[model samples]
Target: MRSKTAKLISWTTGGFLLVLAAFRAPAEVTYFLLSTRLVGSALGSCVLPLTKPEDIAEARREMTLDQPPLIPLVRITAGADGINRDYLAPGKPSWTWHVTGFVGFVEGVPEILESTPALVERRQGGWFHDSSGAATVAFTGYKPVAELTREQIFFASAQLTANGMDLHWVDLGANYLYTVETSSSFSPANWMPAPGGSWPIAGTNWVDIATPLSGPRFYRVKAELKSP
Candidate 1:
């Protein structure tokens, strides 16, 4: 009886140690940003991160936005299997905005899991004519991933134009011309158009003008009409 008890104790101790070794905290998470240029150079941005529910809540409370940040894009939680699962409209305090341009995760933290491009969808109000006599309207959409396919790009472009706005590469009058592209590697620096030139004319759909900024990546642009 004594010998059998000793063996059982040893087995249990070994199993416990093995389980401890297998348990480890997750590494830094990566978040995705879908950026869109809003009116008056005010880039409205959204950030979507793969994170735990607690972390998401903490981030909202801890992080401060210099600009009026809107909407809690979404929240993701870890499952029993240790995978991050998305939970949209978690009924928590989130931010939302009518106009957005530049979307990204909070800087200096590797907690964000993925990011996507911001798509524009027109709402009922927030439409007006710009100084250039173009119809400028405000729209909202969610960013899912950084790299979008040609077809995905077109749908977003069409949605903007359907609302009576033209998408164009605005000349910031600085060294870089502002434009949008769909590339596997999405970055703000690459989205800019060449100086002294414009992107594929304003009316072309993303399919016709999808340009690869980097390897196997693509993007498109929509000119906001000042007067609808």
Candidate 2:
């Protein structure tokens, strides 16, 4: 009977050992890191008005901005999950962001950061005129501060003045491509710059008419983002 009891105890001990062996520790992969059903998460976030002024300057220079119109930016902080760590895994962490997409018709602005590493390229386009053929100004912008960045830019119609044709606008600033084309008739080829030259205003508006536009003429402002 004692022998029979000893054999039963041995069998029970072996079964317990097999159960322990079946339940091994999980791997480092995040897939199985969480419980069967997830509850809370560790998502990353960020704020605007960047800490680095140089980065802001780079962004402004890329857009060829010489005036202040209150730019907006979306700052991002990488998730501090397993991703934040270096190759060593236990090393200190650094943040990064991947910038892409349109700034209103523009494709993929600056790509600031990436885990594997990348680059930020800003390409400003040339004169974009409306073929619809109406009283409208050409559109060109490189304000990468925020997506869909809107600014009040209008090219007022040339008015007849006592001295000459006075050209002014309600709101316009840092227009590097402020080229005014005037024509006696409504023809593309006939349209040319004012008597002096194309006045590309870098900043400010309301310039006194030096060259008198004596007779009736057509005026259209072409704003183009020069190639950077």
Candidate 3:
């Protein structure tokens, strides 16, 4: 009957190309060994062995140190679904990069971000200390002409002399809200620096302003002072 209807239409197009190659999934190689020293200096090393997964996006290792060696600051391609969303699938395997430093009570991985202490008073510099002491003050009457979406708001509004302090102990302390993406073009594929440009206040003045919308956005106010 016409060669059995052309072999049942070529076995239904070879079972739809074997179910689209079994739903194509492969790509998961994670490794991040970024060494850093100076918290007491001396005791930072890197080893080599079994490294081949396309050479980890162009690997380069070195760390002999009296000073110098904390390379490979970029390879980030996480999986199991998270962080930069798995680079691009294809039979994943191969990852190793160790960064070490923690003498006296060694605990690993549990610091998304932690560094608190912010206090800087200036309208005339009458109490300065911001190099991690934290303090960059400047606020001008509610300036958000428009566009203010809210994923978390409360940028800043300071007035704490510290002596008797009370506002529930200055709202408990530790603040972070960053936002900087001034129209884009700072390179390294935009490594933060363009939200009116000028950054170094990182003790918490609420800086966590991620953007993707469009047009006009400016923010400023950093006051990270706590330690009572």
Candidate 4:
């Protein structure tokens, strides 16, 4: 009888060990599956778009232009009174603006030096003009203050006149690439050699006489100063 009890006990112990082993197999498999899934998720999230050789070539071509990236830097800030405006970003105060679009239709008076025509009289900032054709107009104010003054201070100032053709505006579709202007258009003149610095009068650095909305316009300080 004792021998029979021992055999039964051994049988029960063996059964419990087998059941535990069976349950452990699935636990091990579940752990492996979870680890593999996490790895896959990490890899998928880390992938980035591959840069092809063609993309590099295109970037190089865009960089070869004479002016700043013509797409993003175009901006014009005009005041409600039509004066106290600014064309250039704070980072580039010396750059002027260019006007394109309907070159033939847009007409305006020949830019007068220090005349401060009624349109921009006493205005010491920036302005913009749209063209009537497919092109857009842009303008800049290149005023470099020679000095600054306080209660009883004085400064020297200069004028940059855009004296060429009269700018006329008409609604027309004539898409054309923006062509830079000549250097003579933005040459500083009438330099007042004085003892202080103050804001000067307004002048036509660049102007685009287009319809209400022509398109994107480009502005710069030395667009015409590019190498041939």
Best by TM-score: 2
For 1-228, candidate 2 gives per-residue lDDT tens digits of 010000000011322211000111122211100010112222221112222445545544544444532222222222222122122122222224222211222233343311121111111111112342111111122233321111111213334356555554322212234555555553333765556654654332333355332433445454444445
lDDT to native, each model: 0.27, 0.28, 0.22, 0.19
Number of colliding residue pairs in model 3: 14
Ranking by lDDT: 2, 1, 3, 4
Model 1 RMSD to the real structure? 23.5
When sorted by TM-score, best at the front, the candidate numbers are 2, 1, 3, 4
Best by lDDT: 2
- Tell me the lDDT of model 1 at 103: 26
State the number of backbone clashes in model 1: 47
Candidate 3, after superposition: displacement of residue 170 in Å?
Answer: 32
Residues 1-228, model 4: lDDT tens digits:
010000000011322211000001111110000001122231111000113344333334433544332121112222231111121223212212221111111113234321111223233342333342122222112111111111101111112124321221110111211121211111352222111212111222223232112222211111111222
- Pairing residues by index, what is the TM-score of model 3? 0.15
For each candidate, give its TM-score against the true structure: 0.17, 0.28, 0.15, 0.12
Q: In candidate 1, how many Å is residue 42 off? A: 43
- Per-residue CA lDDT of model 3 for 120-155, tens digit only, reads 101113322234322222211101111111111111
